[model samples]
Target: MVSTIVWGTGNIGRAAIRAVAAHPALKLTAVLVNDPAKAGRDAGELAGLGRRLGVAASTDVEAALAAAPRAVVYAASGDLRPAEALADVVRAIRAGAVVVTPSLYALYDRRGAPPEASEPVLAAIEAGGGSLFASGVDPGWANDVLPLLVSGLATTMDAVRCQEIFDYTTYDQPDVVRYLVGMGQPMDYRPPMLAPTVPSMVWGGQIRLMARALGVELDELRESVARRPLDDTVTTAAMGVFESGTQGAVRFEVLGIVGGLPRIVIEHVTRIHPSCAPDWPQPHSGAGSHRVIVEGRPRIEVTVEATDEDGNRAAGGNATAVGRLVGAIDWLVEARPGLYDALDVPLRPAIGRLGRRGV
Candidate 1:
């Protein structure tokens, strides 16, 4: 069993803790948290695992790394603190811990990522002789693994579109919902997530990764965005009220054009409420679904719905992202020290550590 430490305590971090505790090949050694309030807290309690796992959360980076964990799941949020998150991951890597995370978005498809963003990671990997892998639900699985697997069944593929259609009311991140995603803001307010070049910077790599898997070079990477205002006031348990005339729904697509045609597309249709978009595609299950549509001879459409313990699709999606990162731990440790993206690693389903008592 590989000794592992979980970093961070946000949505992804909580899920990683649950995963690490349940994995058969992994022994949860320590958890790293930047928040002093969370310091010395039981790992199980932090993860909502019901029973105590004897591991306590620590605020000391050097001390946690000193434990010499074979792997570390760096689950901290990079949305707001990209540089800090990068530094944290590098610190873990330089300490000889194989690191996996969804924090660094640019690392999702590192080939297309800028040198300044990815080079430091490579340097750290070389310095520590430890590997690194970055992945998440949308850029992680929905675009890379799912699309490539679905495309394999198609003898003649014309276009591939991967979509994340979900209602975001269940998600509890207020800053991200209001500021980053433009929720509860005036229609004129442009969220940083949809700002010029940001979508291209975040999702463009996923498109490029898809193209690379199919052995096709994209002529261009294009971005398309559309927003809808709420027709009436809406309320959610997680986020407060969103008044009418404010941004309620958003739909955006990152298209990879080949020979002047969009051959590969990564689309996101997110809304604060289900009633917001009558015409937009709806999730087939409880919350939302990740749909992969291959348009060609014998067109194929596959919809995937995932849920967490309480049946919250948002949390389930986060868990899947955590699983992708943690599941790759064993494979990553065995591989040579380097920066790895979704395309570089096989989607080995980490199963042994699942279904522990009350987990």
Candidate 2:
């Protein structure tokens, strides 16, 4: 079993901890946390897994790396503190930990990522002989290989549209929902996340990744956004009340121009409440769903709804991401030292995972 360390205790972190403990080929060695209160807590308890996994959380970053774990799952929030996250991941890589994470947006498609971002990682990988893969549910394999794999079923293919339909009410990141996404903010408020070129900055890499994978030459990247205000004052189960005039829903797209036409599209329909966006796309049956629509002969639509413990779709989404990244630990440990992207990593099968406690 590959020794593994999980960093962070937030949404993705909790899922990562649960995943590592349950993975047959991965042994949970250490868990690192930023919250002092969480430092001494049992890893399973931190993950709300009901039972303890005999691993405790620690805050001593240096000491954890000193153990030289074979793999690291860096699930800290990079949405607000990207530099710190990057540094932490770099430190792990330098310690020779084959790291997999969803925090780094630029690394999602290293081919289109800026040199400044990739340079340090490359240097660290060279120095430590470790590998790194950055991926997640949406910008990760869902849009990249999942779509490509689905497109294989089509005799002819035209445009490939990837979509994320989510109700943000269950999403635990209130800051991301209210501030960054501009939900519960005034109509005139300009959400930093939706500002000019921001969508491209976040999801443009996914577009480029699909292009490179499919051998499609993208002429340019384009973005469009639409938002709606709550017609009536409403309160979410988690977040406080949103006034009628405040932004309650958002729909946006980051498009890749192929042959002067928008061919590859990454679209998001996010609502603070289910009632906010009546006309927009809805999740298949729950809080969230990722979909791929192939426009061609025998047009096809594939939607994935992952429901984790307690039937929470958001938790399920996080769990799926953890499964994807954590399941890759053994492969990463056996591979050459380098940074890998979505297309490079395979959807590893549950070889010995059947009838397991975690599955």
Q: Which is the leading candidate under TM-score?
A: 2
Clashing pairs in 1: 22-353, 23-353, 24-353
lDDT tens readout by residue for model 2, 147-232 = 98998899998999999888877677889889999999999999998999988988988888889978989999999999999998
Per-prediction TM-score to the true structure, in the order listed:
0.97, 0.98
Q: Native-vs-model 1 lDDT?
A: 0.87
Number of colliding residue pairs in model 1: 3
Per-residue lDDT of 277 in model 2: 78
Residues 1-359, candidate 1: write the lDDT tens digits. 89999998888889999988777778899999989999999999999888899998999889889878899999888998999989998888888989998888788887878887888888988888877888864537988898899999998999999999989888888998899999889998989999988988888888888889999988988899999999999999898999999999999988899999999998999999888976988888667878899998779999878888588888888898888888888888888889888899999864664455536
| Clashing pairs for predicted structure model 2, backbone only | none
What are the per-model numbers of colliding residue pairs? 3, 0
Worst 10 residues of 1 by lDDT: 349-358
Scored by CA lDDT, what does every candidate get?
0.87, 0.88
Model 1 residue 309 lDDT score: 59
